[model samples]
Target: MTTESLAEPTMRVRPGWTVAVVLANVGVFAAWFGPIQVLLAKQSEALAPDNKEFVFGLVTGIGAAVSVVAAPIWGAVSDRTTSRFGRRMPWTLGGALGAAAGLLVLSGAQGVALMLVGWCLVQLFGNAVLAAQTATVPDRVPVEQRGVVGGWVAVAQVPGALVGTALATVFGGIAVGYIACAIFVVLSVLPYVARAQDARLVVAPAFVLRDFLRGFWISPRRYPDFGWAWLTRFLFNVGNSIGLLYLFYYLQDEVGVPDAGTSVLVLTAIYSVCTLVTAIAFGAWSDRLGRRKIFVVASGLVMAVAAVVLAFWPTWPGAVLGAIVLGIGFGVYLSVDFALITEVLPNAVDRAKDLGVINIANSLPQVIAPVIAAPIVKHLGGYPVLYLLSAVITALAGVLVGKVRSVK
Candidate 1:
């Protein structure tokens, strides 16, 4: 199927909805990175400072495990939904509320068991919102606008991190910080759910148990482009998560920063600025030039190089430089990657389901990264080996993107 022959988008997603969705993404990041990060750190410090990596790994792994299952289920349901408020709205609202409830539980969590339950709830419901909201891109936006729309979503991450950090800092307590993030998440999602319109489907295929099960396995031989895209995203995200998710502990242990939390904000500030600038530029550039693979390959290579820098020089200065490079690479990848995915989907009628399968590549890595890194960080010295491993994984992602024949 050629890009030109694919159905034109039935509606153009408005700027208001786009902005609201972006803010919602920001809220998620704020919750995930800011308050959650601090909370976990405190827990790890209090419970097992010697095994900080292991504790953190376990927490993240639990959440990702839940997300892997929940995301696709929610996506498939959204596809078959025939509601008056539209397919995505109900799930969006439910996801936000569910996530908020989980956040409340996390705010008061006292033990590892409670922490595990709380984060699992967060991941399950948070992914519901993510799956539905992500579908909105291909659902409403025209092919021509996807790059810009993806860019806006991509650029929101940095600001969202900043907002999360500010909330955590201002609240000065994990419980209060979580409450603040929950409120922000609900508020961010409200405008889009309340005001933005989604088209009601007149009819959809009836859900079949066997068909639904089969949908999970899209043959790589039949849809090679989609297969390649999924592989590239999975590998790149795994590499990125290894470098990203352990930063709090990394700064505290490896760099010897007295206040790793504050230092993280500083480095993130640099990374965010670079991501915002580069995302907007590269997003627009991809739209104008009408190319995807080259940008993806370039981003992967850049990230690999950044990982190398961190591996060689394990210092604050090295981290800052690495953050800048990683930001550029990730920013560009985030902008164009979704646009590319939309173009390669095998069945337009099942776009949400297919994208759900693709989304696994994202959520799966959260599980895989911690599982892989925990052993490495625990047994094989420290982060240096991990960073070198990150470089190798990301460079492999670049090479795989070159295998894709569609979307370029």
Candidate 2:
């Protein structure tokens, strides 16, 4: 609660700054879906086609568990940091470097234990960078611009996925792809770190351990809007992860694509276009209309329908259509939902810490979704039933978002 806690919002977000953020986000996500997840899927396939989903779930689920703890802890540390180099930048630099090291380790890993160790490091350091970077949005951007900024973040992710997949395709070697991802992350993040300004925090009474612990516990009863938003985010992210985490294998196993790589790229291309358009358009429109909840609700419903399509069709065409629909819904939701979360944050002084707490909603789902889906995909009717479950959960997320009283 010192004067040190407040960040001076930027007067206007420069185009260059926006582009840096976009590229950084792209590189980060590319590292994720591009190399890490794809590598896991390939390894699982190598081990056993029948056990691919289970193996992937086990690896990714374990890694994501680290993120559930790492993200918030990183954010809390950033919130208290009084570094002249600025609070977020130090973490940003350290995280990117740490994650890159982890990726290198992963590239050379010869055994499951080594791979697990590397991936866990990647999740830990990667989420540290992510928590700090995302906190900058609320720290810098004005309310009116947040939706558009969120759109840019979402749009960056679309190409990040496409480009990451493209890199993997072109490299065709696991080590090469991992190296490329590492390079992209470091290069993409530098411009922002060097050029952007972060408010220097001045501590009055020195940091306290007790205060830090207390900060983590934001009472749901006191901040119902934040609670509701968090719940909605958790549900929606879980739904989304279940659909995506097994997509590579789904193409190979379910749709029977001989070489799933080209098909995945094609599907990602379609998804990219749909996502880019909806993120920009819907994001700006929501800003103009002064509405967020409706867009969020609609997005969840759209995702539900898309999941239903995949469940029923289970073909290349159905997968393509589902990707397109999922992209559209995901785009709009990504654009507006973060803005809503920032609006509902219970405290300004702990913005990064609080956002990190909200980020748990995101990270926890990544862990939970795979764990949940592994069982369902194994015991139930395979990928189709998984998609159906996604549909049900996603639709329920829409209803959950409607319960938030603040930030209409």
RMSD of 2: 1.8
Model 2 scores worst on lDDT over the 10 consecutive residues at 1-10
* TM-score of structure candidate 2: 0.95
Question: Residue 315 of model 1: what lDDT?
Answer: 92
Evaluate model 2: give its lDDT.
Answer: 0.82
TM-score of each: 0.95, 0.95
Cα lDDT tens digits, model 1, 96-191, are: 898888888888887778888888888888877887877877877888889989778756767878787777666667778778878887787888
Cα lDDT tens digits for candidate 2, 1-408: 335337446476888888877777787777777754467677666665767667678778888889888878898888777788777888887888888888888788776777778788888888777877788888878888988986786567678888778777778877787788778778877987887577767662356789777878889999999999999999998898888878887888889998787788889989988988898898899999989999999999999999999999999889999999999998888888888888898766778789889988887888888877777777778888999989989989988898998788
lDDT for model 1 comes to 0.81
Residue 395's lDDT in candidate 1: 87
